[model samples]
Target: MKRTLVWLGGMATVTALLVASTGAANAISRGNMPAYCRGEVSAMYATKPMYVKTGKIVKARDGSLSIQGTVDKGSEGIKAFACRFDKKGNFIDVMAMTSDGE
Candidate 1:
């Protein structure tokens, strides 16, 4: 009876760990992209007090990812940008999105 109780306790611990790990993975997968992009975009723009408003993550046919958004640099006006990343979520580049949709 004691051995059986030990086995059950071990299984319960393993189950709890698995559940916790799954939650953490989900959080990482759905990370705060807007906040993450904000820092990088602000640095690129070289502006203080910048704001980034980003939309959902988009997956391209080439397996890359992009976050489309706008940056507001108070007096400098707002500009559209696309933050590009690899399939593994590694940042590639941030580029201005022109009015002509370039």
Candidate 2:
């Protein structure tokens, strides 16, 4: 009976340790997800034809993202664009944008 109790206690401790470790790893991954998402989007932007200057990349804790930047249009000066991404870092769409009327 004592041996059985010890075995159960050891198993419980191992399970708790595993759970804690997994949780910490998940938090770290989630913490870095926004930066990763921004880098991914920036790489995609670099593939476009126009000259680009990245502005702000916002990644929500829920996995939503918004990226804003300016694209040079040669004779047309610069135009701002805002892009949206889903939680999985998938591109959704882009729209004309400006910084609070500036």
Error of 2 at 26 (Å): 21
Q: Once superposed on the true structure, which residue ranges of model 1 sit more than 4 Å away at CA?
A: 1-30, 48-50, 99-102
Model 2, span 1-102: residue lDDT tens: 999999999999999999888672222244444454445444554534335655566888887877677666556566677766676655566666644344
Each prediction's RMSD over C-alphas, in Å, is 9.9, 12.1
**lDDT score, candidate 2:** 0.61
Clashes of each: 0, 0
- Could you tell me the lDDT of residue 20 within candidate 2? 88
Per-residue lDDT value at 12 in model 2: 100
lDDT of 1 at 90: 69
How many clashes does the backbone of model 1 have?
A: 0
Worst 10 residues of 2 by lDDT: 24-33
- Give the lDDT of residue 49 in candidate 2: 39
The lDDT for every candidate, in the order shown, is 0.74, 0.61
